[model samples]
Target: MTRNIAMKILLSFLILVAVSACASRQVALVPEDKPFSARKNAEIALLYWIDSLPHVLTTGVDNLIPSPARAAAFQSALEALLRDDPGLAATAAETAGYQVVIFNFGDIRFLALADSRHPGIGPTVIVNPNARRELIAGAPHPVFEEGVDIEAGLFVTRLEARAAIIAGAHACASSVASRCATADNVCPGNGSAPVRVSDAAHNTVLLYQLAHETLAHAWPDSIVFSLRGMMRADNAIVIFSDGSRRHAGVEALPNRLRDGVAATSLSSAGKIVSCQDADDDTLARRSFCGAGNVQGRFLNGSPDACSVDASASSGRFVHLEQGGIVLARLRSAAQLNLSGSAAENLLRGIAAVIPSSEMPMASPDSASGPGQDRR
Candidate 1:
């Protein structure tokens, strides 16, 4: 009687194992609709999977993760692309309920897990197993070791990556801060204000001085100026906020001005600037625009009513970076023993991009219209 009962229990265990194996082999069909195809109309979330914090100082493999500097560069470049393309709008990752999510693994490959909780969004493999194996082999320390099986390591890594993505999506969706801005003034502010000019580094001080000098000399009352101090191991940035780019009569001008601003800054700085139109090889080979470096973007072209604030109606977004033209110029000057005048010239070049004459006229009253107090 005891032997018969034991045999029956063993049979049940075997059946369970067989079912699990078959489920693992089954492939989930990708839906007919592409996830990011409607990105222009939908809110999308971006996730960067890096092991270290942005401020942590590390060497070699540690640099591969998306540090604060790298994240800022990628975000800036993406925003610029969306602004010029006229389709997608850039929303903060903190913004909730995004319809699509993009995971950037520092060029590493990852597989998407089947999400049973959301029907029809089953486990889909984003990267093929062969490709994933190759990436893992080349990946930095902690990803690959000498003795352990490579296949097992790859499987574990992929699972972890998928889990992180899902966790990030869930967190963003549930956070109260994720709601879209209802008014322009209520729009999210830049993460933090710039450091004091006196205590900042030489380059930072120079940029801060340039921002003020430009406002005072070039476009006083034309825009609100702010300095984005340098990121860790990154260059300083200056932001020129002209308010909402969307208004009743001149809806499209903000993007044009943004492009013009970037173009003028790049040309006048007298350095090679990278653009999305450049070939991948060219971008990869170039140090300034390469992975983990600064890349500028114009971010004020979204037409979605909920995506932007009332202040955005004034067309008030402009971002300037030291990574490309500015960084190159600074480096070259330091090597050549040149004076501080180079920084000044770069600032003036940026200032020249602002088209004060064509700026949208701001109403005198504070609470009058959408684009009021813009210029």
Candidate 2:
């Protein structure tokens, strides 16, 4: 009996040591010097998944088979939008020939930032205010500045479904633009319109900041538009864009379909809504905020074992929540209810980030091509 008890104690001690050692291991941060050089007229790969079941489900049976037809439709719509854009060469190919890659997975979980040592919610790295100014001066991309807040710690938030899609689209565009800017030594020109606008429902500032970062020149000639979300609701979508400050007695904003969706703006009676004023300090209080703001989460994956695959460093990745725009169409038989008009509008919004002069005019014969298979 004494011998057995001693052996058990020894085994337990060994197990404890092993766990401790594993916990102490740290994952290196992605290199800061990594170049984002996307050539002009470069092919943009659009990768989409039906759901993030692989990340959520444990049992084999729980894994849902994605509908190829749905995936194909989404791909086609996305291709149609980029078909005319001169700045981007859209392709369905995933080969090394492609310069930029955009993944648009439906119902994907945005992982919280993590590492081996601190896996759950990743450690927050505070940036010195002076360093931030220099970083912005050098890069000036949203992915870099979006993550930094007033408190100086990275903030993360869990988003709803549709919001995730919008956020993911914005993220992909920003990444491509950053790469293009780095490669060409000039900001990607916005071809669509001077004033970019979106309804501030469901965190419009996040999207607004993303647009401003990716599309606007250092000194923009036109004002970008962003409005607050619905009354008492925390989420927002781009509902209107006419530069009206008064939220009360405003006419309904037109949706992409020309039909109206019930939406609201920030009340002028209270505080004025501005992206500059809507700093990380204010955002951190929201429940939807992430672990380390946007940049921190982008650099570091989930705070657990499911670290983002840094090895697949082709393009930037973004996780999106399914909100009203996407959720309303969830029950449709098509699986993806995103309309071509809406998709085009969204793409145009992204294109607006690039200057018009930079956007090449496509020939009338420019054919819409199919994108690569879903990964």
State TM-scores per candidate: 0.23, 0.22
Top-lDDT candidate index: 1
- Deviating ranges (above 4 Å) for candidate 2: 1-56, 59-232, 238-276, 279-285, 289-322, 330-333, 340-344, 354-375
The models' CA-based lDDT, in order, is 0.23, 0.20
Stretches of candidate 1 exceeding 4 Å from the true structure: 1-221, 229-314, 324-340, 355-365, 369-375
Q: lDDT at 50 for candidate 1?
A: 21
| Per-residue lDDT over 178-268 for candidate 1, one digit per residue giving the tens place of the 0 to 100 score | 2223221111242332211111111111111222222222221333222121221222232222233222332232233334444543434
For candidate 2, write residues 165-244 as lDDT tens digits. Answer: 11221122221122111111211254322211111111113322232222212211212222112222133322222211
Index of the highest-TM-score prediction: 1
Q: How many residue pairs clash in each candidate?
A: 17, 44
